[model samples]
Target: MAIASSQPNSPAHPWPSLVPKTGMIVTLLFVLLLLFMLDIALGSVHIPLKSVVAILFGNETGQVAWEKIVMTIRLPKALTAVIAGSALSVSGLQMQTLFRNPLAGPSVLGISAGASLGVAVVMLASGGAANAFAIRQLGLGGSWLIVLAATAGAMAVLLVVLGVAVRIRDNVVLLIVGIMVGNITVSIISIWQYFSAPEEIQDYLIWTFGSLGGVFGSQLAVLAGVVTVGLLISFSTSKPLNVLLLGENYARSLGMGTFSTRMFVILATSLLAGSVTGFCGPIGFIGIAVPHLARSILNTSDHRFLMPSSALMGAILMLACDIIAQMPGTQTTLPINAVTALIGSPVVIWVIVRQKNLRASFS
Candidate 1:
């Protein structure tokens, strides 16, 4: 009888190739840190980089107004953008992998539509009353009720999509169904808008434009907690996801529970997408485009590397968009969603056009 070998290059051990991957990881981390600092420092109000660091470290000798600007406005907005970007990008990657479609994303699948619907109900239905007395009676004062409604909307759509995905085997058909769901949600929102009061409609329109500044300091802890929990869940599933890349039957043969894994992915996507859309409005393009960007940069689909790289890339892209939204030259700030769309859409179209064998490779 031959003894099983435990040598470093044995079949079980394989050749250790950590050095290159580790180097890539470290490089990505450094780039992410640099981008984050730039995001915080380069804004409408130009503060010296050293002064920005000092303000962050509790050195209050700097200009009192500059400190207020950093602490109150730019820092929180930049942080929110980072969190939202990371969460949306990861969720999009998971959705694409789960559905095995390049076009899969929260907005495409009506997750954002669900969030919009929730906001519509709160702002249009509940808060539509002419008098303040009626608004108070409906419990729509602060943004909390709207957030709750949006969350409920997102979960509802997620549940529907999960059910559809299970029954529908063809990836193309599932993608179409997701788009139809989004259209249906848009129709609902349109009806609400038509009947909504002008004041309420104007408010809803502003929300639709999207703004990271909508999230206040008080709400940051809750947003961070939700996003952190969802991210951990996604990271934990990387191994199974790698197996899943081999197809459902192969994954099952490897002892993976396809149904449970799919359910968890749906749940995580819902939480991440729902929370961000609820707090920050239906941010566009980051989810749909960031994963592809990360994959193209890394030139590998291995989830172990892809997941974290996508997260950092998403954060960086989002922070950069936020910085752009605050256009340094112009007095008026642009909408966050518009900035993401302008940047993300061109990249997405380029990917579709340039990757000649994209569909064939997936098939």
Candidate 2:
């Protein structure tokens, strides 16, 4: 998690010039609203924007089916996209700041993999298989069960990573350990898959592909609650994260306890990443990409600005991805993971190139 500069705005550092924060924030909010409405309107049914707005405001849209679709299906899905997007992006921002690495993301430490492992246990493990029929029969209750399993799995891994983090001084080594742990978790999932029934394997596979539509009603409420708590934790640590950007020794010199701060960050990230994975499956790219996007757009490293910017940008991106996944007028829908990957891959390449430029400028 160490980087070269121990001072955030040092004279020799090559950070980008700051932009007008207020303007950018307002723009992001407006875009988020636009995309939210668009995501609801452009689904397979193509409900008119007017009707969507009308239904949202408690007015009769005349078409009962449109009202039901907007209120029941698309609205919940859109909200899920917003919540999940912000959760992952904020988690990524915190991780990147903690590691002082542009590529650090929620998945980087295998937290998402751990969550998946939890889901795998429920969906594919021998004991889970025996109760699979009953679990599905439980419907929304079953979904909550999976959410709990995923959160537990994520925390199980977080505990291991934190245990290692406390003993390891090197961020790079901790990163390697996290990756190794994640790989081991994936291998365990694979072993479970191999022995499970084909139907069970298929169910687990769908979960990996991810879906925002799966969360709604009481499920949406739970996801929202979890994410709100995580974001508040992340936001409260903005000052600590800033000091950390100056390196651990400097942070300690400033009266911050390095160990405690690190633990809090890891815990906050686990809650956000773990809960989102539990509810929406493991969403990729946004966690790794949105922070960089926010940093670049905002042109500063201040967590105060970066966190909210990342959240709004993430929500907008997720809503856009969801709309594309719906394929608009077509009944066919693409996997949200696939859509995010397609869009996120390019942003990552840009990040690499930008980092290279930063290095060259510093040299």
Candidate 3:
């Protein structure tokens, strides 16, 4: 691997700046598919991989319960993990690109924080009856409220950030401003918790822990649709994203509207990150950690390859986290957010050790 980097770029690779990242990306896609299948098949009940595949193909697994479990429970959870993972990862990639900061991510920019604030407002302000209200009022459940509120809050904060980004030409200032937004949003959430009922506080806190299984059925479809749209937006902006990699000045000299492109990137990011956070409840770290991992693995900053590669990696990581968190036969599950943090911290440390000039690497 070291030799590959030390030598001239491989001819088989399309991008001259790096090694044969195409093979790695293809390998990742295969791994992601395998993980997706495993996520559905390997659970507490221990359905066989064959049965799972059969169930997915609309064939009964000969056991009613097996079919039900595969179709109803595990399938949706797997799909949720795939979509959420891809969304958060791409969101992170976009933020990292736009900010030209390796550490930038959905949460770093306070978009997730804003989503948290929205959830806090609902669960806390509504008191201990949030669950009942979700099941009763609004007909579609309280989660609908949470999703709407979170998306609203995220979009609102994202808009403010974009407005500021439009006026300010400096990425550093924008980065600090994003941190400040997170701090402010978190402070507000803390105040809400202080005044809320203990039960309400507990409810909000639990939601903050994040969950992949919370979404299923129509909820899963909604997540998939929104994530797909966001991804499409991302692909559309890929060329501009690649251009911006040379820094805003270089992009502008190429007749690219850096500010407008930044706005589109933010919009795509908010949709992707906000929707996932809304449904999954602020699953963190992937948005911060995955892009650098992708860049390091792909050995290039080109968004063309980086976008899909990161999405595939993110889906695999999220599925792996879900598999671990579920604990299979244990009948207990850990919080998804905790797992992400645990997984992400090591990657972050590796990035710090591995990257000499992190910002310049992205550029």
Candidate 4:
């Protein structure tokens, strides 16, 4: 948990600036707070900044509907965006470090793909009137079914990956295997889609597009609880993760439990990815892109800074994307997935091209 000092160093790869890690973290927190507030204030209804602030502080201001809007609708949605955003970002950071790849995230290990497959089986393959009861019995109710199914699917994929990783010693090989598993699951989903009813197919398609506004009450609890625990585990692994950056054998020589650390990381990633996918329907790009953004800002790979900064950066990105998805006026909301990909793809590309020593964090 050492704060990267502000003093300039004479290393082969000095940072572009002399800013302290604390400063970057503080700045990111400020931006995160502002973005979060904006997410709560700006929407189709368009509550004023003052009013939104006042409402949050328990000042009614004579508008009951506004209060309801802030508390019941916008608040939950914004929280979901933040929680899911941060969780996905950390998960991506872990994957990138674990596999030592520039482009790795929840999908890198096919957990989300498995979740999608699970939802497909429930909503598409078993969408008939006769099978509706069976679906509900499996916690695939009209509302939370997709969430549970996605979690189950992600866990299933995670378990398989863990089994393979235990048997196979190569990181590159494990990465490829994860991708292959995802492809196989997706192919099965396609087959399921082809034979499903039109409504079932449409439902599955909508889930893939993603929705942040659907979680609340018990669903929100499940999502929040799982994400919170996952984040704690992720944060705890910062030291081990940093050790991992120097390579496994080097870490092992230092007495770090490489296998146990990997298992912990995988478990945390599964919980974060699974819960978010189950509730939010596989929101993309933030997980894959935000870690690089954090590293570029801090100019260090230290997880102490990278983890919190990536989480905040992710929350900011998600808030902005969620706001854009809401369209800011009238009664229309675009799919969150499209907005994130539209924004995140360019940022990722720019980081790849603009940044020097993309693996500096590892070094």
Candidate 5:
């Protein structure tokens, strides 16, 4: 990423100051590292920080049980947290920039809801018998099934939004269309749940609560791969995204294809948000809250900086939340979704309150 020109009179939209933000960016990366190690170190069973470090470096920890917990359980969980946080945060940043709305996010736009619906169709809408039949006979089970279904569902919603974007120039109207579409998706899922078997409902409910521990091995690899692609796609759009911020008409004047830009963003968002929802469930707040935090800290709208900044901030926040949800030193654990809501709700309120007039935020 190009650093903002140090020259004051440069005509190009100035990027955030490099000197201060570089330090902040480095600090955030340091914090992410600390949190990753901390998330692995703290759990229901206490493991010494030294042992955790040793195990990570392939040293013999001497205690097999501690080693197993660190390597098999905590390591994957912590990695998943980083991936999920970065994916959701960057996806949110893209959405906010694309829609030019402070509140625009995957969850807010119903993209996650759409993903959940796709999973629901596989896990809940079909009778347990048919689902089992498909899994056993067709070999369509496990992580791959859910991830594909979720991605498809998210893509479906994205297409609708894109269709609306083509004809409607007003962002407010587009935002409302997204919300209404998402609500419809949620309602459909609710009705399916109402008819689903109790056991099926229970399983789906657990998925909704969200868990970083659920992904491991091949599943973890898949999540990481998908999120990485999404992040790259978003990063590639930094220049176009900057032009987009000046409004579509100005963007068109500059020979940018507004529709094509929107397509790239939606595609990236689907991969990022959908894969996370499929593996980790519909994680909220990280997407909506992290971008604002990055913007506030960096004091610039440039996507090049905001993308990485949000990724680091999002990972930090997610790891911190995961630590809390684990309720270390106790067997009792809280749902990640609940903890995220507790944290994210206040941030949303802050965005609204601080903006005062919502429309002015985009302007």
Candidate 6:
């Protein structure tokens, strides 16, 4: 009172402090809850909020169709968005950290393209013979064959990339190799597309459109298991990943098993990215953009904080995008890839622009 403080930026005596982590967590939980409710309420078929809530709680007496919609359709779609988003985002963060490159992600590494090639082979080059044989012998059908082919293809690419990463010391060069790998795969796919029938080409084209709603309850278990294992593997190596932030020589000096650490990271990334792409199609932009968004929000590059934050932020962003994709007023939904690109590209560009010195800094 006697004298005004000279420090104007002191924030008027700390200003009661920012919200605590617990408060932030609670707020995020509430936001997720609201988003979940919105997802249930605003689908193609109009369901009243009360009925949606009742259906969720198994108390809907006269709303069987609503219950079915909420439980069978929208719930799985929402969960897929959450799980796929978290998995892709966390995987992207791990890749970026391991490579010391902000632009690294599963798609950029051509894992998705590998998966796409696999699907193309199965659907086109395999002569649709495998599908017929599976339906006849094992009772397996169309999409299941595609999923298996995609998963196998993604894993194969992962192995190749891991091998290359171990041999190549430069991250930028490795990235270029990954891009080349993707291009090669695309060329193979194009060849197959040219030789395949129009109907098969249409099917492949539709699959490429990407959709979170593709995973049903029956397939959720497989998706959940693979993603959980992948994430756990990544989480366990947080210490190594953190070490990796310092150059490989520095990590070796610090007693880290550089080769093994790199292998595990690559495998984990492949699993996470592959599983999501296998089930949801090649989801674009989420992996590349979400990690940067998390870094910006947390203001720290620590993997310990960044991974979890990226997971949550990714889930929220993906869920919101899926909701928009549904386009409640329209009968048809927008492609998930398109929505993600529209939302994520600008953010990525901003990150690149704002961090103009990132390349030199990392180098």
TM-scores of all models? 0.86, 0.89, 0.89, 0.91, 0.87, 0.85
Model 1: residues >4 Å from true position, as ranges?
A: 1-20, 131-142, 162-177, 347-361
lDDT of 2 by residue, 1-363 (tens): 123233457678756434335678888899999999999999779888888889899998689999889889999999999998999999999988788777789998899999999989888873754498766665622388788888899989989999999999777788889989999999999998988889888878888888899887998998899899999999988889988888878988999977778888888898899989988898888998888777767667778888999999899989989999999989899999999999777865777577654332112
Once model 3 is optimally superposed onto the true structure by TM-score, how far is the C-alpha of residue 153 displaced, in angstroms?
1.5
Give me the candidate number with maximum TM-score: 4
Model 5 lDDT per residue over 83-160, tens place: 999999999998898888887897756788888898788778666576645643533224577667777888788788
Cα lDDT tens digits for candidate 3, 6-122: 544566764444345558877997899899889997777888888888989998657999888887888888999999999999989988888877778877778899888887877
Model 1 poorest 10 in a row by lDDT: 1-10
Evaluation by TM-score, superior candidate among 2 and 6:
2
Better of 4 and 6 by lDDT: 4
Question: What is the TM-score of candidate 5?
Answer: 0.87
lDDT of each: 0.78, 0.85, 0.82, 0.85, 0.82, 0.79
Report the lDDT tens digits of candidate 1 across residue range 266-354: 77888889899988888989997888877766666777777888888889889878878878656778889999999778876787568
Error of 5 at 149 (Å): 3.0
Displacement of the residue 361 alpha carbon in candidate 4, Å: 5.2
Candidate 2 clashes between residue pairs 3 or more apart in a chain or in different chains: 1-171
Please give the lDDT score at residue 190 for candidate 4: 96
Q: Candidate 6: how many backbone clashes?
A: 0
| Local accuracy of candidate 6 as per-residue lDDT tens digits, 199-240 | 677777877988787687668888999999998888888888
Off by over 4 Å in 4: 1-19, 130-142, 359-363
lDDT of 5 at 219: 86
Better of 1 and 6 by TM-score: 1
Worst 10 residues of 2 by lDDT: 354-363
